[model samples]
Target chain A: MQISASKWLDIWQANRRLTRRVIEAFPEDQLFSFSIGGMRTFGDMIKELLAVEGPGIEEIVTGVRQKFDEHASYQTKHELLDKWDAETARIDKFWADLPSEKYLERVNLFGQYESSVIDAILYFVENEIHHRGQGFVYLRSLGIQPPFFWER
Target chain B: MQISASKWLDIWQANRRLTRRVIEAFPEDQLFSFSIGGMRTFGDMIKELLAVEGPGIEEIVTGVRQKFDEHASYQTKHELLDKWDAETARIDKFWADLPSEKYLERVNLFGQYESSVIDAILYFVENEIHHRGQGFVYLRSLGIQPPFFWER
Candidate 1:
């Protein structure tokens, strides 16, 4: 493998840290309501991300699948952040149970989206980066300097 | 390696195709002037992608570095798309010169960022995905649906 499973975890964690900062940068009011070009607000985007990672890893580890849902709402930024932090811990715990060899195994994510486990995980990361990019623009439009993209 | 170098190239090309569709979706006038929340026009974002990939790969292949520049202007969307197609070819050509082993080598990209050649390449893809996400919002704001992210 070009990268060990643990190395990939580290990379994903770095990206998660940067994403946490993006969440922090948002003003509470704007986090859920401020969106440009008709895109979902940053808060909603976070919900989609939150819906995927921990549960996805848990499914991978347990050989179980759940319906994908991104509509679960948080009433405030603080609640959302708390959920995000909890998901992070959940992912770490499930990740420990995932054998590295399982990364090469194919699985149907969320009872749909069949792909190798690694690809599914990559999708989780890629999807986050994609939304976070929008978050970056959202911050910029608000005249805020988003944390550097490379800092991850 | 978890993925072969050729596989990475194929992945990048798929992304390039989607980004091309994004460029096509833009109205010529809006492509250059449209902004939401104070973000740069989509045209300017394309310039940065153009500046990075071909030259960055060339540097990796030739061991010669040049100053990064994203200021080169295009008169129309057609011209920018042409540049995009040309860079696609350039990346393919340079990619051929890069040995699989070289992916693990570290090089300073544009005399600034430093990382393994693979990470640098991953950044190129990740960066494109990032910007493309912003483009999705731009298109949605304009009421045009961007290409499906998963199609890549």
Candidate 2:
């Protein structure tokens, strides 16, 4: 069950690619405003997801902590997709220099979630799958078929 | 991040516990037939998830390949929960015996997906999270509040 930090970077990148496709599937109109029952819209979910990456990983790579923020960036679907792509490249740049053994060491994620870097890393992928699931629901409700999960 | 094979077992088990709570949130009558739109009912999604573990991990451990089967088990929520609990324990029993190094080696999952055993193991959790996201939508549409994502 051990994953090298490089392999984890690959895994994270793959999932992020799939998530980008999920964002693409959204009708721009419903991306942020539609909600099932009282649940938050896909936009809000996406924002929360975007917020988790850059700062969280930065904190791990550097010992500096940061507060989680989802509301400050990207108010539109186009902007979110751009931000997602940029974040993808950001990880590509930072992930390579990250030592695999560092994943085994503890990192205080966002100064709130305190756990091993591996656990925090897993949380990134886990959170995406969860949010994408919500997006799938949103798409189906709007009569759109999301990109197939296996395509990733 | 390096997760010993045993620690992966713990991580998987913790996530399973949360998923079980999600199953518990479903109204007995709606667990099987509920859908957000044209999406498969949460029950069918659950069955696909149930099919992945047990036999999948067993194949990794015993080197005896088992075909994927999602339709052959469970006709009711009662049976499903029982199966889920049993599978949880089954993982506990077998997961420890799995060599941590095996996770670094590749295994063709259910004769289709091929990757390192660690990737396949992560898929088990990722797939469940995806389906559970659908379950969340189903619950919300039915006027039920689903379990919180972070509870895991």
Q: Best candidate per lDDT, number?
A: 1
- Superposed on the true interface residues, model 1 gives a C-alpha RMSD in angstroms of 2.1
Which residue segments of model 2 deviate by more than 4 Å? none
What lDDT score is found at residue A13 in candidate 2?
85
lDDT of 2: 0.82
lDDT of 2 by residue, B4-75 (tens): 666777778888888888888988888877777688877788788888988888888888888899985576
Instruction: State the weakest 10-residue window (summed lDDT) of model 1 chain B.
Output: B1-10
**Pairs of colliding residues, candidate 1:** A2-B1, A2-B2, A37-B141, A141-B37
**Pairing residues by index, what is the TM-score of model 2?**
0.93
TM-score (chain B) of candidate 2? 0.93
Q: Which candidate number has the best TM-score?
A: 1
Q: Which residue pairs come into collision in candidate 2? A: none
Model 1: how far is A112 from its true place, Å?
Answer: 1.5
Per-residue lDDT of candidate 1, residues B25-49 (tens digit): 9999999999876778999999999
| lDDT of model 1 at position B58 | 96
